[model samples]
Target: MLPLSDASVLVRRGDVPSTVLDDDLVMLDPLTGQYFSLNPVAAALWARLERPVPVGTLIAGLLEAYDGDPAIIAGETRAALTRLVDLGLLLVQPEQAE
Candidate 1:
């Protein structure tokens, strides 16, 4: 498991298959035959994973788009990202060299 940090980059695991509904997203791990669904917020996050992104960038974007307590938003986003990682729907990698 990777530690959740502002510097770490997150990306969707390329092998997982995903579907998008009106405001929801579902991912299926064909190998494991496990399906996971994301709420609207998580769906938005998932949509952002078309390419790798830094954790801090994700939080900053959310903060700019939504009205909420910064700390609460950070904690919930972190937790959501962690769960996505654990579920094999997402992967964490070292920040890319650019």
Candidate 2:
């Protein structure tokens, strides 16, 4: 598993199928026939993964949009990203040539 960091860039897998129901989002992994559910907050985070974005940027955006504690928000965001990566629903972008 890739270690998530502030600079780690992440993007959702376009091939995976997903749908929003009510205030949550559900995704299906056809290979394993496993389905995953995301709460409103996680769903919001998923929406942002349409394009690659730095983990720090995601945390910053969440902090600005929510009234939660800074540390809690950052920690939860990182945890969520980690889970997504482990599930193969998200991808870590390889560093490009500088």
Candidate 3:
């Protein structure tokens, strides 16, 4: 399953229609026709959308980018990921053998 912090996806609008801008690490939902920007950390996480990463890994990445307490970063990352799930931007992946 995708980590809670790595749950959200980024999307943007297109001339023809909404499309998943994977190259740009963004996705556009046709229904909303709105653009969403993924923060640097989120953008990095989004780049690995195809692969499901663990919560600890995501937090570690963020911790590298921002100097702060690991616990606080972990909590915030989880909350951000949860918000993305609520927005229908992220999907939970079924666990698989590594």
Candidate 4:
């Protein structure tokens, strides 16, 4: 699993295509011709991932928008991100020098 620091940036690969239907997100990986279905929370995350997003920012946004224990929300968010990365659906960029 990728060790995602708070500053790690996540970006969706440009070639992947996805659509939302009845609260679920269906994504196709063109290269592998594999399809992935994501739940409502992940669909929402996908929308926010249109642009590069920092992990910390993602967690904070989820906390503000959803009702859940902070720790659980953060843990789930991280796990979801790791799965997306492992599946080659998302890319993780190391913290940029500033």
Q: How would you encode candidate 3's per-residue C-alpha lDDT over 1-98 as one tens digit per residue? A: 34443333333112322234644445555456756666666666555444556656666677888888888888877776666666666565544455
**lDDT for residue 61 in candidate 3, whole number 0-100:** 71
**Model 1 bad stretches (over 4 Å):** 96-98
Residues 1-98, candidate 2: write the lDDT tens digits.
75687888999998889999887798998778899999999999999999999899999999999997899999999999999999888999986656
TM-score per prediction, in order, is 0.88, 0.93, 0.56, 0.94
Give the per-residue lDDT digits (tens) of candidate 1, residues 1-98. 75698988999888887888777788889879988888888888888887999999999999998899999999999999998888878888866677
Answer with 1 or 4, whichever has the higher TM-score: 4
Give the whole-model CA lDDT for all candidates, comma-separated: 0.87, 0.91, 0.57, 0.91
Winner by TM-score? 4
In terms of lDDT, the poorest run of 10 residues in model 1 is: 89-98
The candidate 3 region of ten consecutive residues with least summed lDDT is 10-19
lDDT of 4 at 56: 97
Error of 2 at 68 (Å): 1.1
- 2 versus 4: better TM-score goes to: 4
